[model samples]
Target: MKKLTLPATVPVKELAERLSVSGPELIKYLMGNGVMASLNQSVDFDTAALAADHFGFEAESEEAVAEAAPASTRRRHPLLDQSRADPKSLVARPPVVTVLGHVDHGKTSLLDAIRETAVASGEAGGITQKIGAYQVEKSGRKITFIDTPGHEAFTAMRARGADVTDIAVLVVAADDGVMPQTEEAIQHVRSAEVPIIVALNKIDKDGANPDRILQQLADRGLVSSDYGGDVTVVRTSAKTGEGVTDLLDMILLTADAEVEPKADPKVGAVGTVIESHRDPGRGPVATVLVQNGTLRVGDYIVAGQVYGRIRALLDERGERMQQAAPSTPAVVTGLSGVAEAGDVFQVMANERSARSLAEERGFAAKQQQAQPVRRITLADLASQVAEGSVKSLNVIVKAEANGSLEALRGQIEKIEDPNVKVVIVASGVGPVGEADVNLAAVTDSIVIGFNVRPDDRAKAAADTQGVDVRYYDVIYQIADDIAKAIKGLYEPTFVDVFQGRAEVRQVFTVDGRPAIAGSHVIDGRIPRNSICTVLRDGKQIARSRVAVLKRFKDDVREVARGYDCGITLEDFGDFAVGDVLEAYTVEQQNL
Candidate 1:
């Protein structure tokens, strides 16, 4: 059988040709699998794999193939300790931890209690900490706690390839058995492969059932050791100082038993930027967690594309420090610009080499893989509503995670309108597929996607059927949009529709004119005067409007695949050979 290597998404016509079959025949096969797609419409990897199998072909995704590479030859993350450094120089370091749980649960309260107890127990004068992380000493051993907005930020940093948390302290309220956010946190921590130590909070409250909470944790696969499981459970209350020290001890014990984090302090400092901002007095300030080596004042450091010599180093207590050891988080000032959260920070030899390396990284990452999540704020969707404008507003909710699904549905139902009512026609998890669009078309409902995009089949179906689909990353936007729509203040949302993709095979430069990329339409059709993005090595390099397009010396509106053409971008001049251009058109969608 023939073997095919497929990207995350593939156009139907292109896949049909690769399968040595007609386009209609492939469409028939897709219909048999309940996937509706036109010849030019793209399909995800799973769908394409099934089609390839029907024709006696083996298909594998690019990601799977990369993961199958030999471990010896594959490059490792530069920040990891196992990547380099001599074994003789390695020394034991404290484990960094993050507290996560439901919103009402005492995650912040637990952190505050630890800090307060730390000061009251034996520590000398303590200053109010403003840095994103802090360390507390127990029995002469220090434990770092990263202050973040629960598992959302924790999971986000991990997604960027920074495993900052060595242990996850899951704070579960005794009163509430297990909420949606608690379950979500558990899934995220488990996926990160971090050891979880349950902090059963609110045991001091009336009718706070610790047994019920322990049973709920077991149901979620985090069984306590008392129940014959390996998970460590600690009972504590932020209201009173009960079991707070035990929680800290549990962190230390878990660290020693599971994660023996060590690093060579003699080498240059390497850390992860937890937070950064433009401080009016201090300039660009960054809160970094030192994972290896020792970061000292006057050390040249590079965090992502920004690099500068550290002028000052301060701990989480806001006290000046000469150096920060492994597992110690410090606030540093003197970076050229504000480093992004989760960016790897490395101490370099000198200023010149650091600047050169930073410049090279900046050019390569002209646009980093840091694709911003589509965040639609409340102010963007907020509008005054007119009474009796909408009798009923229908919607179909879809998300990438199930934990947020029920909460989103409940938030939508809670929106009170004087005359109109909100109705959820259908709700599900995963990407929006053809079946979702079909349901929306028949029910007169708009599809709402949270932190997920629609598949090619769904996009094509929605476009053809005139069904509106709105996507948002944060839940606040979805709730606000629904509230506004029900109040008769419905505002239209604009989305990008995939047009086609082109690959630059060659470059032609004429005298006294701009250079044109000799490109071939690899899939679908590239229309003239459309928005285009230049992608090199799977990373977006530039995005601009199509200024000029031609085919064989003649101005044409669109050039389809299997045809060669010349194209020029409006504002982009740097076009390398092998660069792929993805074309798109703006579409306005409304409730």
Candidate 2:
């Protein structure tokens, strides 16, 4: 029997048409193996290999098939080598660019002007609301623009050390020269190390001053092209469309100087998510940029924890696109859950395989959590190291607000010793409580509390359980003490004894469980089962039992100054994130 042959590349729509299946139907089939794609998106040869397997065919390589097939059969697959064609030779390849600037700096207006211009020239109007990537042709050259909101989202990717941008267009309003966000954008672009073209926007406004903007740019080390500097700065009014073409021309020149890599459709697909969000209509929607491989409809994909077949692929203009390759960003529908923004995505073989890989990853995460962490104090660290115990300093940070929490966390993470590292077991914005104490107790870690205190019952519980609950209003003190602890230079200063002044930070309500109060060590280490008193407004509120003591959600022996713990009250309750927990121990003076 003569063997039936398939083309290496087929139009995404044509495949569905030939198979009498909808675009989404073909996409679902492709996605079974972990290639997230949509109907309009094109699938390459390797992807077709999987699709052919689904159809019960022994998939053959494109080269092998080409050698076996007659010339008449080869012409049917026109989309196969389009992406592999020379990037410079192909006028169809759109230049992907991102616009970045400060808030209210006409960043949106510039994009609006571009959209308006394209529409006025007979392009579609529905493209404006799409995520910043879109195709616009200027002087018959295709250009793709990514309209990022500000440096926050721009740098957010860099925080993960991923550079997904090809070119960065720094939008600086002529009237607003060198704002904080502008400097931030400059820093982000520099950090990203991508080529940047400056847009001196809103030039038609009354307050416009291009010269001042240029001077400000010089202050930030950005020397403009017109001033013998390498940076290209274009002054334009988005309202009047003046200098827009000049800006586009400069971008084209920049792109011409830098060659973009073309992908081999025969290889497996690897991509990155430009954006992702949860939608009511769709479970998880992600905007993906195919950097080096071909993505087709129905390709199964793995992005972070989510795994699903490509249900749909929407372009920046909300139009269904057949295929996306290098520099092509498309909105993909069909993920198990919302993947984090900037997560790397790749195509897999089948739905079952993709699900298996995802499940394996999930199990691995659980296994990681189950793995034991070594805790070495300053006194025991050297001996432990000699005994082959190398571990990080496990910590639980409790703060009053998000900013302080983040700031302190960043500073603590900046402590760069390999032997001594800081691992935040759990952190939240609230008062230290019983849960914190219990966690610390188990992990043998200290919980640091900032601008918050613990309650009466929590203090007694911490005292009874010997869990540490440390409080600090100043951030440097916390960092310094942690450093000292890591270095074994931590001294029990400030009375080397318990006077019992402490505070509360938070209270946690575990479902179907009793309430746990989060508290801090205000003054002196609250020793286990020490005599304690509960004072509210300098008066005895109630005397209760010390029910539990926890550190980093783990049971621990004790906690010292500048630490936090979780504690349960014996009888009294009513506690919150910023209440004080005072503890006391009788000082025995031997003569």
Candidate 3:
């Protein structure tokens, strides 16, 4: 038998020809596996493997095809090629700092205060929203600030292996003390191995206690230098601009005392995508922060799968610039599409080289999508727990309204399992869709929808990608489900709640045994095999299990309220005309 050559995905007809089988036969084989593919329809590796086994042929993924080719054919991204740089040309660059904290903790306000101070000092670039980034001048030096929404965006950018930031400024509200998101931000900063400069904000508010905030920081492993630790804590109020200058001074001092932010500005520009969006006038715009070299006008850059020339370079002031140096944030126009946030951007030799690299990486990404995915299930949580792989249960929540989503998020995050942390990857209002499933798959998170339903496409993708999609009408139910999952062994118990009462009109004998009681359902429907209690004038006579419930001569599952039906109970013989039959059902609720 000849070995079948498969490119990540292969058409049914093409595989059939390689296997010497008829196309219809291959399609029938695929149909047995639940993949209804036509002759020309492409099948992923799983489908291809099954077809190849049935037809006595060998199939390999596209990665094997690349391995069979010459080593020179495989292209490495230029940004990863460290040998291309010259150590002699390296120079000190501004430290790229990310301000992370809980929402409304003065993260944006501190950035604004720094920008205003820099602008007052005759800095060329004013604050620009295009890149969500800016640079502030301090002591004849520059410190770049990436104004992300929160710590999640900061971690998401780092998750893509784009280590762009040199330091993290952790902002904490003095009045609020240490919040849940504050701890999360601290973890992200520590995980990234970036030094943190604590910015204690909101000191102007009533009941503000900087000392209390410092004590809380001690509990989280962040001791202040005043307390005989290396961490620097600067108390600042962004609203009044008090101690804001001191905060900037501390950032510069920390950068010098700790790690020196240096880059080779003599080489081609290499950086990361801070933010990206589509503009009405421009085709695709990206807010890129150049980490190394100098990005100039007309430079061809490839960011992840998107490649384009620098049609225009706009500084943080929204004014056109000729070039941007290391740690400089610039809005570049003319990308083929909006590159993903956190995608690494590099300047190639020419447009053709950039295009070729993008195409190569794009193809490789598609091939990775074709590989088999091991779907994580509730049962697998045990194995993950044993392997210590499940330290946290990451969740993406979708809801019908912002208020409900926030409520659900707040309650779910409170599900405390010291062994397993619960992290909310993303949350929004609306029906759960494919985008949510994609994010969950990428982050190894589960999609949780509260008072919302997943569309058919999202459901299918979740199943295919092995992402768990759970729907709940009540907020507490979702919380309980996740709590049980993290605990790994907590089984729930249920109690039977009475549904309704019915009166027996008459009784009939079947095969010489007390069989059916002809009754009228007084309230609520009576379900089949539900527990019933025989009562005589509000006094309990006996309790029996419902054997069968029938409406008329037909065997029906349920008898609705205000309807006549026959009910049969096991191990019960006595029947009375005035007897009442009460029905109840048991439902399991997680504790």
Q: Best candidate, TM-score-wise?
A: 1
Error of 1 at 125 (Å): 6.8
Q: What lDDT, from 0 to 1, does candidate 2 have? A: 0.66
Q: Model 3 over residues 528-580: C-alpha lDDT tens digits?
A: 88989999989988888889888788888888889999998987868789799
The lDDT of each candidate is 0.78, 0.66, 0.78
TM-scores of the candidates are: 0.56, 0.52, 0.55
Ranking by TM-score: 1, 3, 2
Tens digits of per-residue lDDT for model 1 on 369-440?
A: 354323222223233225433366667788888798888888888887666667776676788876566555
Ten-residue region with minimum lDDT total, candidate 2: 72-81
- Better-scoring candidate (lDDT), 2 or 3: 3
Query: By TM-score, how accurate is candidate 2?
Result: 0.52
Comparing 1 and 2 on TM-score, the stronger one: 1
Q: After superposition, how far is residue 169 of candidate 1 from its true place, in Å?
A: 0.3
**What tens digits encode model 2's per-residue C-alpha lDDT throughout 330-367?**
89898898877756666776776566556655665577
The window of 10 residues in a row where model 1 has the poorest summed lDDT is: 372-381
